[model samples]
Target chain A: MKELSLNILDIVENSTKAKAELVEIEIIEDKTTLTVRITDDGSGMSEETLLSVTDPFYTTRTTRKVGMGIPLFRLAAEQTGGSLTITSHHIDDYPEEHGTVVNASFDKSHIDFTPLGDIVSTITTLIQGHPDVDFKFTHTVDDSSVSLDTRELREVLDDIPLDNFEVLLWIKDNLIEQYNKIKYK
Target chain B: MKSLAELQAIKERMKNKIVLREGTGDIRVVVGMATCGIAAGARPVLAAFVEEVSNAGLNDKVTVSQTGCVGYCQLEPIVEIYEAGKDKVTYIHMTADKAKEVVEKHLKGGKIVAEYTVTDDN
Candidate 1:
């Protein structure tokens, strides 16, 4: 992916495929480091699956020979002298608390650091595609932060779908307004 | 800043429209959105479809969504359109611009853009 936002989208897609009902995406930008942490309450992976998740050749899919989501994400972070870490608890093992967490940290000073492009679009796209699923998104840069939680919107909208075009547009505009507040980073 | 008050107003406006759409059939526009598709630029394609469908005021009659890997890596960024009681039309290797045309032609005009559809080779 050309942008880190695209990688975020790809990883979250994996979460949804695993039957996650809630996904939380957090981006924290510090002085010289950038970190993206995605947590999902999905059917987590097995030990075998978790071990080979970063391997481009290993995939649960029988149709194709490779799965590139985690692998590419790892590459993107490593290219900037950063690292990617994933932890999961399968339902078979931890039935009460089964989910996955993906944390990738990057050295923003590195020349190869990828930019975060059009996160507003990513957020809106995720909501538009999966209106039933809930998402919590937060981006923190310096002293400024922006956040949105669908649960709140759900409380407000009793019968309306989250994918309603006007609602999605409102979300996009809200995100834009929030990003505009993060003037420094 | 976006406030809940504005959303409340939008909800009020949408109430009548929602009731009118209750019993009618809705078309489905599904886009491939796996790693291959994202790498091939399906994000923009999906976004374009959403915006175009909204702009054309077809939200009541159409729904746009995404799918996992289509298993055809070479045909990344594929899009499929399904109408009730009809065969699904699969469009391959789509871009943002192509998504708009597909919306206008196949979606709105009730005519398929055959050239963009997959054939035996594709």
Candidate 2:
């Protein structure tokens, strides 16, 4: 994807597909580096799958012959003098610890690194698209930070749907406002 | 910043309508969002569906969602529409504008825009 937010959206979809009930997405942007970390409580990958996940030709889906998400993400980070790491433990063996964690770091000022595009929209789309899953998003820029937890919102929402148009609008605005406050400070 | 109070008000006003939509929407709009789809710009198309569906007040009859892949990488950014009693209509090489048009003509007006469908050239 041309934008980092799009990449974030694509990567997180894997968590949902893995049947993850809870997903955490963290973004840390500092002076020289930008890091994105996604953790999920899902059916984790086996050692065999984990070993081949970085290959563009590897995919579990029958609909397609290739899975470019990880390979492309790895390329983006590596091109910027950064790195990507993925760690997963199979559910049967690790029960409580079974899940996946993807950490991708990039040189913040690298010329080839894409801009962090419309992250608010990305988060809201995930929330609306997967109403059953809970998401926690934490964005940190320098020393300031903000977090939004769907679990807390669910408590407040009571019977109301989180995907309600107005609710989504509020979420988008809230995220952008909070991120800007920290980024421009 | 937008207020949560505003959302609450919307919930109160549209509660009945929302219920009607959630349980029995007859039309489903699914966007392909796999790696190829994203690389070909499906995000904006999905966003357009969300915006137009809301703007046209068609949320009661149409549900917009996404799928992983449809096995047509060359036809990235595909959208499939399924009506309750009709066959699925697959539209390929979609853009945000085309998505808006599909929402207007096919979704709201009940007339499929044939030129945008995958079978048009076949």
Candidate 3:
């Protein structure tokens, strides 16, 4: 993807596709580096699949073999001399620990570093499409930060779905408001 | 920051109205969002559909959601619209602007935007 947030949106979909009940996304940025971690409580991949995820040709999908999500993410980081790592435990193996964690880091000092685009749109879009799944997102730049956890909202919403048009708009506005607070901090 | 307590206010407002999760919309708009689709700019298109659907007050009559690749990476950024009686209309290589037109013309007017539809079913 052209921007980091679009990649974030794409990777989170993989978690939801695995039927993840909860997805946690964390982005940490310091002077010269940026890191993103996405953890999902979904049906994780086997060790065999994990080894080949960085390979664009490796995919579990039956419809056409190539899966570019992970590969592209890896490329985005590595192209800046950074790194991507994935850890997964399939349900058939560790029933309790069956989930996936994808962590990628980027060298912000690099001239080719990809820009972080409209992340608020990415998070809200994911929620609108899959409101049933809970998402916990935190972004930290330097010491200032912003975070949101849908599980907390669920407690108040009760029966109201996150996909509700009003709720989704509120979420988008809320996220933008939070980001604005930290934008100059 | 917009606090959770504010959302509580919305919840209160929503409680007074009937929640309509059941008996879902008659029309469904599904956007393909796989790697190929995202690469081809499906995000803006999807966003436009959501905003326009809400703006048109069709939230009760139409549902917007996403799906994995339809096995047609060549036709990335595809959108499938399903209405009660009509056959599914697959629009390929769509954009945010095209999405708005589809919403106004096809969805609101009850006529498929044939120019945007995929020609070959194969």
Candidate 4:
């Protein structure tokens, strides 16, 4: 992907496809490194699926022969002197805690690291696209952090759809304000 | 920073407008966003539809959304449009510019841009 947020968008689509009810995305950026972690409560992958997920040619989709999300993300991380890891627990083996967690980190100052694109759009699009799924996003830069919980927003929204243009615009502005405070502080 | 109060005002104004559109079967625009699709630049295409739909104030009549792979990796960044009582139109190898044309020509002008469709190549 051209931007880190796009990568996040790509990965979370898998979580939604896995039938996850709740997906959590976290971004932590410090002076040295930038880390992204996405955790999902979905039908976790099998041990075999998890092992080969990083392979660009491996995909569970019957529609296509190649899955490039993980592999490309892994490459992006590795090229920046960082790493990517995926941990999953199959539902058959762990009924109570069945899901997948992907952790990718990149050196903060790496020349090849892509900029964090418009994350507010990325997040709001996902929330609007999958209204039934709850998403929690946490972004931390240095010592400050901002978090958004769609479950809580849903409680406040009540009947108004999240995809409403005005509501989505508000969300984008709010996220930008919060991220700016942390980023510029 | 925008306030929630603004959203509340919009919600109040939109409530009835939105309620009337329910079950009316609006036009649906689905962008492919699978691994291959994203790699082929589907994100901007999706964003363009959302933006153009809203900009044209056609949200009530048109809904923009996404889908996973559509079995055509070679035709990544594909877009499918469904209108009530009409067959689905699949556009292949789409870009944001092409998406804009689609929104303007097909969605707004009621004329499908035949040249950009998969059937055009065939």
lDDT of 4 at A119: 81
Off by over 4 Å in 4: A183-185, B120-122
RMSD to native, candidate 2: 1.9
Rank ordering of all candidates by TM-score, starting from the highest: 1, 3, 2, 4
TM-score of each: 0.96, 0.94, 0.96, 0.92
List, residue by residue over A1-185, the lDDT tens digit for candidate 1: 89999999999988988999999999999889999999999999999989989999988777878889999999999999999999999989999999999999999999999988878888888898889999999999988899999999988878899999889988998888888877643
The order by descending lDDT is: 1, 3, 2, 4
lDDT of 3: 0.90
Q: Estimate every model's Cα lDDT from 0 to 1.
A: 0.91, 0.86, 0.90, 0.86
* Regions of candidate 2 where Cα sits further than 4 Å from its true position: A183-185, B3-7, B14-16, B19-23, B120-122
* Model 3 CA deviation exceeding 4 Å by range: B19-24
CAPRI-style grade of the A/B interface in model 4: medium
Error of model 1, residue B77, in angstroms? 1.1
Write model 3 residue lDDT over B1-122, tens digit each, in one string: 56788888888887766455458699999999888898899999999999999899887789999998889888878999998888899999899999999999988998888888888763
What's the TM-score, to 2 decimals, of chain B in model 3?
A: 0.89
In candidate 3 the C-alpha lDDT for residue A126 amounts to 94
lDDT of 4 by residue, A1-185 (tens): 78888889999999999999999999998888899999999999999989899988898888657888899899989999999999999999999999999999999798888777778778987976887889999998888898888777666677887777767777878888887776643
Q: Sum up the clashes in candidate 3.
A: 0
After TM-score superposition, what is the CA distance of residue B17 in candidate 1 from its true location, in Å? Answer: 1.7
Docking class of 1: medium
